[model samples]
Target: MSVRPIGTDDEALERAALRDRHLDRARTRGAVEDAERRHRAEKDAAAGEHGIHDVT
Candidate 1:
């Protein structure tokens, strides 16, 4: 592999770490949204079984 200067290496490492953090946050947000959607659907289904319907 080609050798990079110390500063360049540090910059690259920092950028990679930042990118990873951003990706992790996005993944976590997507998971939470999915779980919320599923929970809402289940709650609505249960309400419907009791003859309740959401107006909004």
Candidate 2:
């Protein structure tokens, strides 16, 4: 495989930056979804303890 010299390619730098940004966004989204899921589960458990039924 041929290795291109770093700091000499503008297009490669831009593509790498874009890829990093996309990965960061995906990680953030997954964290948020996980937090929401845990919160919902806890809320459901609490309601169940009190004999409350979720309508939705």
Candidate 3:
């Protein structure tokens, strides 16, 4: 089996780190948005069951 180094240069390492950070932020944002969406859906459903329509 042949093994290769993960990064060849400092620039490559910096770029990879930046990309990872961006991905982490994106994942966090997505999780927050998903939670917000679920909360809104549940709230709307609860209001609907009580014969109330949320205008907002």
Candidate 4:
């Protein structure tokens, strides 16, 4: 086998951590979007039951 430097493992770990951060951000964004959609749907339903229309 060939000899390798000691810092290679650290580099790999850093890359993995960066990737995890990106994935976390993406998941958080998706959750927020889903929550907003649900809130909007509920609001619209409530407005409809009261015979209200959105002016904007």
Most accurate candidate by TM-score? 2
Name the runs in model 3 displaced over 4 angstroms.
Answer: 1-29
TM-score per candidate, in order?
A: 0.46, 0.49, 0.48, 0.49
Give the alpha carbon lDDT tens digit for every residue of 1-56 in model 2. Answer: 99867665887889999999987897777975787889999999999999999999
lDDT score for candidate 3 against the true structure: 0.88
Local lDDT at 31 for model 1: 71
Off by over 4 Å in 2: 1-29
What TM-score does model 2 achieve against the real structure?
Answer: 0.49
Q: For residues 1-56, what per-residue lDDT tens digits would candidate 4 score against the true structure?
A: 99878678789999999999987887777975787889999999999999999898
Candidate 1 ranges with C-alpha deviation above 4 Å: 1-29
Give per-candidate clash totals: 0, 0, 0, 0
What lDDT tens digits, residue by residue, belong to model 1 across residues 1-56?
A: 99866677788999999999987897777975787889999999999999999988
Cα lDDT listed for each candidate? 0.88, 0.87, 0.88, 0.88
RMSD of each: 11.0, 10.1, 9.2, 11.6
Better of 1 and 4 by TM-score: 4
Worst 10 residues of 1 by lDDT: 26-35
Candidate 4 is scored at a TM of 0.49
lDDT of 3 by residue, 1-56 (tens): 99978877997989999999987897777975787889999999999899999887
